[model samples]
Target: MSDALDQLKRHLAPIIRLQQIDGLLSWDQQTMMPPKATTARAEQMAALESLVHELFTSEKTAVLLAKCESALADAAPDSDEVRLVRVTRRDYDKETKIPATLVEELARHQALSHEVWVRARRENNFSLFAPALEKMFALTRQKAEYLGYRHHPYDALIDLYEPGMTYADVVALFDSLKPALIALVKNISEAERQFDDSCLQGDFPVEKQHAFTQEIVQALGYDLTRGRQDPAPHPFCSGFSRDDVRITTRFDPHLLVKALFASLHEAGHAMYDQGTPEAYEATPLAGGTSLGVHESQSRFWENMVGRSYAFCKWILPHLQKVFPDPFAHLNALELYQAINRVQPSFIRVEADEVTYNLHILLRFELETQLLEGTLSVMDLPDAWNAKMQEYLGITPPNDTLGCLQDIHWAGGLIGYFPTYTIGNLLSAQLREAMLHDIPNLETLIEQGEFSSILQWLRQHIHVYGRKFLPQELVILATGKPLSADPYLTYLQTKFKELYAL
Candidate 1:
């Protein structure tokens, strides 16, 4: 490497460490810090982010990048340094266009609003969180304007999580899936096979919930050596590095399926992180390529594997062991049907498969309107309730189950919701592709073996990391750019079996 390249590393190393410090602080804020620490934490994050920006955009750094880019282009594509330079260059170019004020405001709101959102969600009061959300929307509009766009403002936003993904594409995907999902829901709506989900309701106790879910996550092959699972109000996965992956979930005493499904889902994400290219650790290419790809992994495990009969058959005995009173008479078929039950629900996190994307679609629509200046923050609760009624056919009695329910906008993730469905779509596509390699996926899952899926993910997607755009990874893995066919097919097949249509 050239002297310039060495100097760049010397300057950038401290920035990378600062980023890690911010990450750890953010994780601790969510998992352990007191509520009073919100403002302090936000200031800390803003300061570190400012430092990163200054270092990244410095005159000397640009000189180093100019030098390194030339050398990196000539190096083997498989080399770690080449990939890091390429990935870092892309981030540098993109982030440099964004003003520091905008970035800091995003950080600041994410911290304070998160605390407000928690209380508002708990109290079912959208008004309490409305002002902060208003500030967030104003900042985000400035963001989309700064980012600029050719066809749609939302397209610029979409590029954040799923590069090359257009707002138009998601609309088309959601439009096509709507009829199929509606039909599936209608079919099951008339079915006589009603599951007594009441057994899953009532005071079951959180201690047992954690213990049972812990076993399920372990069986899913989460590496305790490289990762950990914790409890958070809204479950998520994050890390300082690939080897330090963390997953979080919340427990509800009255709900048996909530914590278990959450752990498996988050474990899927943890597996993806833990499986990321080891050579890329401490560099930019070390995690899933995008939120969409990350979501795909989680959805794959939660739906394709966790909700499948094969997995249920394997875990039914153990689930029964946890709460014998509620589960003793229940068989795998019953459990599978219950977990995958088609229901119109208020909360996105708790929504079943048939109606889940509708929840995301609702967010996409509302956020689109909000960003375009057509919807006001104060009016959001009404708009949210109306959409819930329109989409899911049930209105949340309060904001806690409606506008204030999700942690996304409160965390300044304005353009992130669509990826949840993108992940759902990509996960199904990846599952279809995997069946070609492991035809007996059901048998493998029944044996409590998940390495087959993880191995395929590492080979096809994880190893490349951010070296590939999200869409490029989709093409490499599924032989297509992006579509809703696989997701629709899976839902139709599984629900058709369950409802016997």
Candidate 2:
């Protein structure tokens, strides 16, 4: 039995490494690859990804998977051997459904589509990217069809990123959040006092911002030896393995909060990767359980801690030292208020906690509509503006700020938007649980101590990886099923006090 399990692990290790190599290529395409190399990179990505899928879905993999499953049939359900087989089986079944040719096509298009998005966004012309996007969606729809689903085709797509999550689940979650969110937005708008965020906006050098952000992420427990940070159009974290995680942040030369918070956000992800046990490397359990759980860590660090008053106090001195002209004389409460000010924003990444989920809600609806063919790609810009007006009460003046803002669709991430909201909800739930276990969590933040918090995440969330489903991991970490109550309460309490509503 042990030998069968060992063979399964050994067989899967090279496949995992190949997948990581594919990921590394993706990271390079986004960060370091030259614009002119798009064609070559696309071919490279297609070949590598097609090979990975073929290897993963091979007859040998199937035989090993079956052998391991049979051998571990009577093992404890939670044992690593059993969980590894379970996760591998789930992945194997999904991968084997689609043809290698389809995999190659999707990979090639994703790479080409990303370059189109970059150029289109820079030129503020959605038309330049529209055809590629349409094709990507077409391929994605074909993918969902191949994967099969009981209800909505979107369910099959969403499950790839968030296991067991359905379109109905997202709809119900957002439906429950709408009334509360609307009330909060309304109350904040009509409040007697409004926060002044001018302190965060001013002349700040990019070099200084880079240096300061590095310090902040490192202080947040991201191991610099094992990880590094870079700049990207869209900030993201990529982990090839636990020891070689990397993060990227977008910088705004005039705004201090952009890079600072983005770094903390990506670092939260990097720390999670680094915290996973060394034994899980090159296995299905190496990274996050789901994109939603992964987002929880990033949002938790970026908002709950980095935007908290205590964090303001701890980071202010560092801020002043790095860029004194703006932060030199600012008080902790003032810094906190500036960073946490509630308002509708054009960019989702720069949005405050109070208005962040609204952005996700808009994307969720648009993506689902596009997937269902109810919405045409050409009319997507107008549809996006309508949703923005309806949800956030603001309209982006250009495609760059509107439909072209996110790179998800270009990368064929049709059902990925809802996970951001899921992350927000789980972050608050985790915070609530963390406070119960570590009463002085805020105090620790004020003193620049994040060991306990990271340790808590490591034990309860990071270690399990894909061994558990997202819902199960949430319940295990927070002692509750996934819920919107904590997130709504967190936003309501924080913003009401901030605005004195």
Candidate 3:
């Protein structure tokens, strides 16, 4: 059994390395690659993806997996060796069902479509990006058919990001959350605006934002020795390995939250990557268990910690140092209230915590319609604006602030939006569990101390990597199944106090 496990690990190492290389390539494309290099980069990425698909789905890998399974038949089910084999086999079986040609095609189209989306978003022209989006969705539907689903075609797509999560499960979760969120949004909307965020609006320099972000992330235990931060059009985090994680955030010279909160969000992701167990390195188990679990960590840091009053108090001095004039008269509590102010927004990435999941829910509904062929790509812009108006009571005047806002659809990430809401729910759940264990957590944040918090996460969440599914992980860490009650309670308590509603 030991010999077979070693052989399986050796077989899987190169595949993992290739995937990491792909991630690096994607990071470069989004961050530093020259605009003219798009064509060559797309071709290169497609070729690499094709090779990876072939390698992973090959008969030789299947035989080795079978051998390992046979060898480990009597091993403890929860042992690392058994878990690795289980995850790898599941991935292999899924990959083998889809053709390598389809894999390369999707990669190539995603790269091209993403570039088109950037241009379309900047130009505020949906026509410019519509054909590419249409093609991507067509391919995605085909891919879903290849993957196979028991009930809905979208089920196959969602399972790719969140294993074992069905369309029915998501619908149930959303149904449970919608009334509470809508009521909360209505309550906050009716209340007079309590905080003036005018202080955060000023001529902030990009350099200062970068420096301050770096400082805060380092203090939060993101190892600058093993990772670095860069700028991107859309902020993201990529991990090539546990030792080499990279995060990117965009800067808005006129807004403080753009870079600040984005930095914390991406840093949360980087911390998760950097904290993966060394024993799982160079294997499928070395990264996050799912996109939902991954988003939970980012939201945990970005909102539960970064948006808290204690965090504002702790960072006030550094913020004053960064932009002395704007923050000169601003106290920590004022800044905290301003940052947490709830209002409907056009851009999903910039939405407030209270309204953020509404944006996701809007996308979730539209994407499901798109997958089901009830919504045409040509009509997406209208549908998006309608949803925005219906949900938030404000319609985007243009496509840029509407359907063209997000990069997910362009990148063929149809089923990824729901995870943001799932993550938000889980973040509050995790925080509830953490608070029970660490009652002085708010105090620690106020004092700019995060080592204890990071350590607690490492022990409870980060170290396991992909060893368990997201539900299992939540149960293990929080001693309960996934729920929206904790998140709803947290939101109501926080916002009712903030808005004095």
As for candidate 2, its clashing pairs are none
Rank candidates by TM-score, best first. 2, 3, 1
Q: How do the residues 198-277 of candidate 2 rate in per-residue lDDT, one tens digit apiece?
A: 87777888888888899888888899899888999899999999999999998898997888888989998998889888
State the displacement of the C-alpha of residue 141, model 3, in Å, after optimal TM-score superposition: 0.5
lDDT of 1 by residue, 218-329 (tens): 7777877787778888998887777788888998887878888889889888888887776666666777789999999899889889889999899888877778877898
Ten residues in a row with the worst lDDT in model 3?
Answer: 190-199
Per-model TM-score on C-alpha atoms: 0.95, 0.99, 0.99
- RMSD in angstroms, candidate 2? 0.8
lDDT of 3 by residue, 285-390 (tens): 8999999989999999999999999999999998888788788889998999889888898988888988898898899999999888999989999999899999
Name the weakest run of 10 consecutive residues (lDDT summed) in model 1.
194-203
Q: Mark the regions of model 2 whose C-alpha exceeds 4 Å error after superposition.
A: none
